[model samples]
Target: MRAKAFDTKVFKRILEYTKPYQWRFNGVIVFAVSLSVFAALRPYLLKQTVDGYLKTHDAKGLLFYVTIMGIVLLMEVFSQFYFVFWANWLGQDIVKDIRIKLFKHMLSFRMKYYDNAPVGQLVTRSVSDIEAIAKIFSQGLFMITSDLMKMGVVMIFMFYMNWKLTWIVIVAMPVLVFITRIFQRKMQLAFEEVRTQIANMNTFVQERVTGMKIVQLFNREAIEADKFSQINDKHNKAWIKTILYNSIFFPIADIISSLTLGIVVLYGGIKILNGDHFTTFGDLFSYTMFIGMLFNPLRQIADKFNEMQMGMIAANRVFDILDTKDQIQDTGIIEAPIFEGNIQFKRVHFSYIENEEIIKGINLEVKAGQTIAIVGATGAGKSTIINLLNRFYEISSGTICIDGKNINEYSLSSIRKQIAVVLQDVFLFADTILNNITLNNPNISREEVILAAKKIGVHEFIMSLPNGYDYNVKERGVMLSSGQRQLIAFLRAYVSNPSILILDEATSSIDTHSEELIQRATEKITMGRTSIVIAHRLATIVNANKIVVMDKGLIVEEGSHFELLNIEGGFYKNLYYSQFLVENNS
Candidate 1:
């Protein structure tokens, strides 16, 4: 993508974040002007000491001027200290605000957004890109402003001292400005490439590390390493391009600055030798200092401008996420703190992709406190049904209702609050088991969790762990076995005391003993609450009040386990017999 020369829109949006810290921003401007004035006054003082005092053979006058210059230096030093401190402080404050906003926006987005976004890319946006934006305040925009003001004041002093010598310095400026302009454009593009490559590397590393077990099990370590090396090389080359441009620009700039100083000295010396009244030794001395002051800020401006450009680019990317319309709109006004556990899907049609329905006109119902079991082959829209019920994805057409009210009419949080789901693959945070079970909900106390665990008959199992309920599960609960994690998930769901409970293949991958515990826990949890159990194991759902067999996205059979088994040609009958035969043979 071609980078914009400057993104004023993005820059303005970033500045909007500074409204809370407007006083600090205004203070930065005040300090910039003060420092510029100080810079100009020092050179003028030096000129006065040289010509006005020393030429008159007045020691007291010279000492007075030197003392005044020393005081100005001290004031300038203090201003600079506060300037640096406040500018950095302002940047960090702004960064903290933007990071919070970005994360909160991501939290509001529907699962559809995360379905396509890489986790590592989001990490880069939140951490690395936001850090680049901080430099805009600490080192980029305000710094450039201060340097420009200093250069301007210094030029005014140079011309006032001796306009003849000032012309020599101005003569070489157009060439330097032209070089800086070229450097800025190239650097912007280079930095853009650098940001993209950094995101790519982050995404690659995050995925590989998260799935390292798969890499080793498949014996693809060499292949994955080669891919990573290629990504690393691209990242290196992108950075080298920026470094190469810096390497070329600074030396040429130094040469121009040195040549300008030499020209002023040569031309002024000739004028002095000719006894021209306009050229004085003091004026020449001040002009040389002025040239150094002038050219140095010009060079530094190039560096600071590069930083501002990077901040603008990073801001643009962050705003893209903030501007996304992928959030599931929470327009429902009705607040139902409790659901009666009645659910109905009326001609519900849905799709993850356009014109490709995943749930084709699904119509089903479960009465209050009924245990309904949905069984189907893989990709038969079984899990999609659960996702739809939880409002993880919006339906394309038709309506879902809980307790005779359209699900969309109920507040999103209220709807989710009443339902708890335990999936086939359980996920637990890297925290103590108690915290994972309660999810840090302040209302679910430790005593209540222990009570729920005891009721579910897993209290003894948890007590056997290193720290009982306080055991740290580690990342994704990898410290525990799969069965152990599932039990924790069961307890997590149980403690919530949700009005509706969903177990989506929760027993598919556990040991027989763990399955028995889950079955008993499931029986207890489903006693008074409506439960929907989606199972691949035929035996597990035999006791469900209603057994619904789905084929593709349509329900092909519905009955009690015995009633379905009595139908010889029925889908559930064949499925149950097949599973039964497999168990008998094994």
Candidate 2:
């Protein structure tokens, strides 16, 4: 099923994340209100300065008035700096917390979710979508709340000065709101479109850059450029839509504002002639200037509404990730999960997608400290079986157990901590050679890392490097060859010394020389552990304590190599004779 968007309930839940920072949030509210009051004070000062001092021709009074107004303005600007600064800081922190939750939840999802989903889309949602929410959390929040407060105070003071003129200004407000909202809706739609296009663009770039060598080899540059052009056009159109709508709204707002000022001049001129209450040259003049300053905050308040709406859309996407509850929940509380290196699958059935089984109702049992080899053709579900055994995907039915305890009964972390996997395509971190071996287990010493490396036959090579154990592998260990990279993967798993081990075609990439070294390492490493090897190389399975030959999701034969070879024309016998005759002869 496609993911669902958030409701108002989700927004409330998201706000609850801020509960821990209530004190900081309260400070922001107080600072924002104070800043707003200080901002509106300048207009009041001008009115008082003009009516009380300038018209009455008191030079020292005007001087004192100017000085106070200057101080207030300076203080307002200063408070604004902190107000914006703290809001931004809080926004970044909130995004970080939300992103962490998203990441953790993503990991909890079943492997099928990742297989079907796009990597670029997930990254953009986690990073950029969350950042969009943060932008509103920061500047947009302070500006909107502060300006709205200023609007309220300005209205009250205007009424106090002149009630009749207040109605004139108030009458034009509905027109401004109407004009403002029309663009606000348009801007929100435009930004939403832009967000979608940006995600698509990210997906395109991700696919292209990650497969750049493939693109060059296949001469697919023209197709990639064409795809990018389409996304770019969509982004351009969304941007133009925003500009076109804003152009209509802001100018109309300005015109309506000018109309209000015109009304003030018209009605107030008559009032002044007739000595109307609160009407004079200085009062009217100062009110007119204040009215002029009102235009920006009004437009900005509308813009903030538009911004918040877009952020809310992005926030909904973020919450979708957080709200997902995968079936693969690990509730086990084992402090030290010590297993006997025995793994059994009892009538296990698994399907990556609904109604299509890749592994169907299979039974297998392994003793502690036994090496089992899984042999199968491609698409025969060998890797899927391994993945399910490791709890990467929950089975459709049946039980996987270690030492007779259901796999689900153990905490995922503890279960995973007891297993180490080295796949055909090995992955390495962008770090020192030593750190790649140890990963997150920080207590590991340099000597221990070297010990694992030596066991895997890469210690001599690493020692020859310029920096030895400290030598950086760069991103994904790109500087290393396939065999060297495979050696590092071996070292990592060896260092973990997990009770259960998985080597999924890990030796498939190595040459004859490297394979010999790897085979020697495997014998040492798999000692005293339940080792499961998925391989096409029949020679490797000759030494396995048990060999299971699978085809079309069922184990057709199982036994030790000699025992299987003695079977009359069975699948394992035929596979061994055809694939490993040379190795057998040698």
Candidate 3:
């Protein structure tokens, strides 16, 4: 979409952030006004020294006016300093608040939002776009206001000294303004394209870096590099458009400004030479200074206008995310610190997309402290069940309950705090093992993590590493083996001491030894908690209190492992035997 050159709604929304810093914002305005008044006074002082003191050869009077001019200059310097400092200070503070607010809002979004959103695009919105918004305050809004005020003050002094020459100078203004209007619209469009290309490049680079292993493994480096080169070129071209506009617009403005100065000098010098009483030499001198004062801000105004335009464009983008209503509602009042772990899904139906159900009317129950295993092939909605129970997604039409109370009645955080999940694809931040397990939660002590690790029988394995619990697992735990990462994930879940535990194919990818360790840890942890295990490996769930067989989003069989095995040609029986035959052959 083509961006508007000025968005009033967006500008007003940005102004709202200034509420907390009202005093500093007011200070910026005060300094701006003072600077403008002082700037206008300088030329007037020089006119008086020239006409009153110099023409009469009054040396003492010249020294006196020069000293007064020096004081006004100092005051002007002071005002300019605070104006810049406070404006930038206010901008940084507002952007810091916006970044924090945006991040916190993202944290509350449903999993569905993230499923389709690009990670790099979100990063751009949070980092780069917000930085653009800062320029609104620092270089855009306040600077434009100050420059406009200076222009106004200079114009008034020019008109007061000689209205005839002032009219000549004003003649060139309409042409400059016309050119600026056209430049403003064109530059806005160009900047919008620049921002879009920047986002595209960021997304490409972020994905490539994150999946660098796959890129190299599949010998796709040259291919990916060529793709990145294309994206980078687009970004470069977008930026060049803005640069091209600047080049064309600024020189045109300067030429118009220079031509206006020539006209003022020609007209004013002729009026003084003709011995007109209405115009004097001092008037000519001050009018020239006035032209510079007026036309300089006039030119800089266009540049600042571009800054404001880009900031508004960025604000519009940033506000789009802030205004999203897809966040999971945390309106439930119930706060159950500990759940009884009696989970039930009553006629639950869900779909990530409208009218495309993934879990079709699933009705299931697991009594307190029971171990239930769900087995199915890929796309069978097995993982969807765990997601629904955890409320990472809201069911389309259904009721889920824990301890006979509807899950919706519980506060989201309270309910989530009572359940822990360890997924097949484990994720660990780059941090010490202890921090990763505790997730830097202050309440979770180092002693507690160590104690939980020892209980799970992975303490020795951890200690065998470079620094035991202190060893840093690099980004996504790339420093550790897949099996070791799973072990760390188990320890993380175990340390939470959740009432309801879930393992979503946690052992499907690990080697025999790590699987053994995880299996033993799993048995120990599931002793008193209600557990749901979704596994492709049927062997792991043979001892489960109940086994569920699923296909095409429906429960095809439900019973203990032996009971399902005894059924002739049953779905569970066929699935179990197929896995069994594959294992024996391998």
Candidate 4:
């Protein structure tokens, strides 16, 4: 839903983007004004040719006037071209800047913000909504300005030709104005509905398309199609409402214009019949043309006004994102070229929601370069610990520190630079394996990436592909198998050479062979760094220096693997025996 009135603040903010390209826009405005003047002069020239040359039988004068009119027509053509070209240029440049800023702003937002905001809505704001704002500059605002100026000049000339006829034309203005007001109001509602429908449609289509495999696999295709049909039906209705309003409004405007034209013709004919010599035929002809010119712009003004209104509505939405304060505040000023990776969690507690603490009053400390493995059941806050360490979500209470300094004392980028996480679900961009590993980091060159991959034992596997390291993973790495993507994720993390490495169930879903390779790669990468392994499989983390077992948001057991296995009925020992029995049976 949109507000009924135009938001001045949003409009003003949109106009501020135009300031950078104001000179180019000024050129466009110059052309627009010239075009308007040229249009007004056309009818005036016709009046002169009709009365001054034709009535007087001056052939030479007629030829000169016609030649001048032809030149004016040529000027109009150039003016029109440059006007459109420069206006579009200005608008495009402004929106380009806007899209870049908006996207960068989106990147800065915290995970919590995205948890609630839909991807499709963000895309609409950045793409379609920005385009709407561009229309305001290129087509709506400037075009309306030119049209109003033309109408003004035409009105002045109409009064000059015949005051009585001008009054008759003026009388029709009220009716046109009334109709335009009604049309604009109705169209505003229609356009708002259309925008909402488009956002909803985008959300539906994006999500469904991304998850189309589930739809087809579950044999819910028909059901989903019906759902889509319902959404599309609403989208259809929204646009149809717009068309219906336009259909009613434009014809009424046309009728009013035609009636005014008729009145001018009738009144002029009667004046001529009454032998009024001053009311010449040429004057009446130009007056009729002027009335047409005036009403034409008046009608167009309504459409342009709607465009501006829509743009304003779009501006409001975009500004809402730009003005969002729900971002990870990078207020920490500490700079770290390298972190020793000494980490501590003291009385730390957190929740994704209020009064539903997932991690409660946990205390742990790890020496630099030590490997610690945390084993837990699902929803036991194993991954939550990693999230908190990364500051992906701020802890609700207590402190988490790195290298004896509060984690918040270092800039997020500075801290993240020294930490790398290989998640269970590996995400790879549609890019060559080399770039995927290096993430296009100039600091980590191709040679460095190859060296890291080779050291981690994935370089040979990567080279086995047709394109070697240059293989394109395609979207979400769908071209690769689950294990291959995991190996790539490992290589990507290894290449970063982070001081702190987090392997969050990295081997959970891979095949046995891939697991062996990953486990070998894991040992090499974690040799001289602080590593935290979140594993469901006890076998994978058997080599970890220390083991912490968590349950129901508290550490139930903590010790070396053998030390914990000796604890009678200990949580870790019981979980280990259970998993061992399962593995043996399988």
Candidate 4, residues 358-410: lDDT per residue as tens digits?
99999988889999999989999999999899888889999999999999999
lDDT of 2 by residue, 512-553 (tens): 877877887788789889999999888776889999888888
Minimum summed lDDT over a 10-residue window in model 2 is located at: 1-10
lDDT of 3 by residue, 492-573 (tens): 9999989999999999999999999999999988999999999999998999999988898888899999999999999999
Alpha-carbon shift of residue 14 in model 2 (angstroms):
3.2
Q: Which rank order by lDDT, best down to worst? A: 1, 3, 4, 2
Every candidate's CA RMSD: 1.3, 2.8, 1.4, 1.2
TM-score between model 1 and native: 0.98
lDDT of each: 0.92, 0.82, 0.92, 0.90
lDDT for residue 352 in candidate 4, whole number 0-100: 88
Candidate 2 stretches greater than 4 Å from native: 1-10, 270-278, 334-336, 580-586
TM-score attained by model 2: 0.94
